[model samples]
Target: MSVFMVERDLKGISMDDLAGAQKAAIKTAAQMSDKGDKISYIRSTFAPEDGRCMCLFDGESAEQVQRLNDEAGLPYNRVVTALDLTP
Candidate 1:
């Protein structure tokens, strides 16, 4: 397992859509959390009209988590960093 700090740039996402996306995120988190792995959401900022949103996350490997997200049809926008935190 590893811990990473992910940062994203925004584009456009309505408040309603943001809520829906977050709902999806939480559901995805539940699955991720089940495997002794999880995501701790740091923050999210969005601009509704043009469709821009940025979200921060601190948790497992970005690569591994991306796979998990892809499995659930919710891949990450980008991988900020990935580091091993196993002891």
Candidate 2:
């Protein structure tokens, strides 16, 4: 399968929410992304100033990615979009 990335905008999450030992949301997301037989990449970034989280999953299609996010208890409100700089 090909790779795909899902961009997320997380609002209302405080810096404290992103800090310390409670990283279950991120851990769950990684596990969910690895559920579809194989593993490629599962990543997330936070814009603390803006309270936004941009998550990227590289595997399968939009539907598969959405499913994984849903299973991970994440926000699945996404539009079909992508970018590639490979040659």
List the global CA lDDT of all models: 0.57, 0.56
lDDT of 1 by residue, 1-87 (tens): 444443333345446756776676667767777877767555455665655565555666677656544655543467566444436
Error of 1 at 46 (Å): 0.8
What's the TM-score of each model vs. the native? 0.60, 0.60
Number of backbone-clashing residue pairs for each candidate, in the order shown: 7, 0
Clashes of 1: 7
RMSD values for the candidates in order, in angstroms, are 5.4, 3.9
lDDT of 2 by residue, 21-42 (tens): 1254456546765664442444
